[model samples]
Target: MSEVRVILHTDKRQALLREAQAEIRENQGRIPAGDFYARKLSAAWRRARGTRAYGPGEDQDDIGEFSLERFRDLPVTPRESLKAQPLRYAAVTPTEASEYYETTGTTGQPTPTPRLAEDTIWNTVSVAEAWRPLLGADERVVILLPSDVVPVADLVSGVCEYLDLAHIRAYPFATGITGWDRLEAMWRTFRPTTVFVAPGVALQFTRLLAQRGQLDELSSSVDRLACSGGGYTYTAAAGPGPSAARVGLARRTQGRPALPGGEASPGGRHCLHRPHRRTRAGRPG
Candidate 1:
């Protein structure tokens, strides 16, 4: 069962969504790739000096105009920097940051990654644009991902709010609150039309349904199942692909729809799975 449930009142969420939409509108729906990275890297460079190799230096003032050559010249921060000294990477102060989160440390040590209102709005709207076609106001979404210190749940919540779609968080791994049994009970009443889950968890849930002989009855209402996680290992030659699992869950569950992937620290996260047409051959994309 789920432990946390923080609902942003409808009015507040709408206001925030509008701000995100305006940002996209002003940029003409797409920001130049080079200019986006140039601004981000430049801001990161202006942070407080430290013993880190990429700290401020004499050449800090004159970062030339945005160009392919100039962008390449900018210092590239190593992935290990987050694990070594997380605070040094923060471009905003504690007061400025609206929310605080940390990674699962699956790949390495968990790192602190705080976010601002701007971060939430931008990420929400960007993903909503790509997912809007697949979602509708009449549909109800069930998000089966971890919410504590993880940005994926929050990102999905933001997208739902932005699109004015109904949604609920029912992470089955949340022991007492959203355990498999409890979630099964909730499904009877909620009757979600869409489900967003991780690949591993989705498989586990499917097995649970089949064991209980309720796979068809419980999954009948669900038409869409979107999975996102660290990495997908399913292969058509050996391991089970998404199509095989989808078939077990429900007859109506549609083809794979792309959703943005989240990191332990989900700052500036973007789409991971690309939308693909459903194939008769059932190949994993």
Candidate 2:
């Protein structure tokens, strides 16, 4: 029952972060880099598992099939049974983890999503770099998403920290999550340049604002808006917004028809709080 302990050196961690950032900066968005990095991480996971984490006496892959060559194979993982209970899916033990996050589970019960610093460090670095182009270089952001262990708010806050953008995290959204009023108060005082929110909640919030005759104020206050989840139209990147404004939701973006928003769905979770691959730090289903 012994556990595997990965002692990643500081230099190696820094190197990983540097290379991840450089991958996006030097090459096309993430075409081949995503696959490349996934393989690299799989290898690292295998190495870290070593002669301890798997079981009492089980060592590394005994059959020598751990290699993951993209376009030709699947990456190595602990077991297929793990998928049935995703809340506990992880390469390391909770006690060994340097950090952790979880599902806001607005739809049902919550779940845990844990991780190590090594799994997150580069993912965090790469995300800030990826978002810099679409989200702007220095626009202050207000995250109006969940903030559980590794919720959207937490990740955006991390990206802002990495990129040096001024930002604030609103409380997690749910039926009675005592933070909408707080966010409104913050909006009045902080005047963030952009707002990141889920589509369902954003629509609800916008309706409430319109009822209070504050929609104009919101549009004028923030120059950019990023929306995640379905019910949005995706289009190629261009300067400014488009024209397909939703019914009863007239965006006050000067004369532009569409708002400066698109889907941030790298994974199923829509880490648009942020996500290159961020659900937990930067990876999720």
Candidate 3:
């Protein structure tokens, strides 16, 4: 199948982001504590085959009590089925979708996932809101993540544009394009204050700077580092010595609890990173 071009309605998404941020602020970051998922589940019950196995119950007519037992009763969709017949799990048809993305197929066949504009807007707004406290107008962002055939890069890029921050897409892994040398050159010229990078790439780039004895010169300018994708090690963003403290880099799992050096944010497992500090970027746990 031919690739579907991604149309990012940046202006509209940005306006939505702003609206979402305003709503979040007004609500004090609190969401309806009651039956949120149940409401959605009730609405999707008729169309969602994943829930078709459920026996009829009187409570199914409305937003029923969502208990662990009730949830446990729902049938799990196997990966094979998802790969072979993705439409079985979809709420919208691929034709109705505005954007398309695919899994890496590392586990099996690549699964095609189509998304609506609402998906992009909601995801970007939620993530951007979580990270908003850490970013500012003066922040120049360098994204060292893949932009081809995946949604991760787009998500971060959307958040950057939504927040009106200056950012560039330069993946070091894209050899002959934004290779290590090119990335280093760009780093020097761009002097990015913030970076959203993959953990492995962050380590590789840090090591490159160390080998050239430019760690201090180059790293000094970077105040914040946010990493996603792959297994992360503390040293990936910390570099060596007191640089962790100097740069304010701390590693935490997303959405757990705020680490000692980091500030806490609500929502998602990837919220444990200390956004208030310039140095630590982990999946905020």
Model 1 over residues 64-144: C-alpha lDDT tens digits? 344557557767668786678877667665666777777652245777776766566666676776677667779898887
For candidate 2, the lDDT comes to: 0.50
TM-score of each: 0.68, 0.63, 0.68
lDDT of model number 3:
0.57
Per-residue error for 2 in candidate 3, Å, reads: 22
lDDT of the candidates, in the order given: 0.58, 0.50, 0.57
Model 2 Cα lDDT, one tens digit per residue, 19-84: 767765776443574567667666654644442433234443332334445314534555444444
Model 3 scores worst on lDDT over the 10 consecutive residues at: 259-268
Give the number of the best model, judged by lDDT. 1
Tell me which of candidates 2 and 3 scores higher on TM-score: 3
Worst 10 residues of 1 by lDDT: 231-240
Which digits, one per residue and each the tens of the lDDT, describe model 3 over residues 55-90? Answer: 244354332355546666766757677777766456
Clashes of 3: 25
Which window of 10 residues has the lowest lDDT sum in candidate 2?
Answer: 236-245
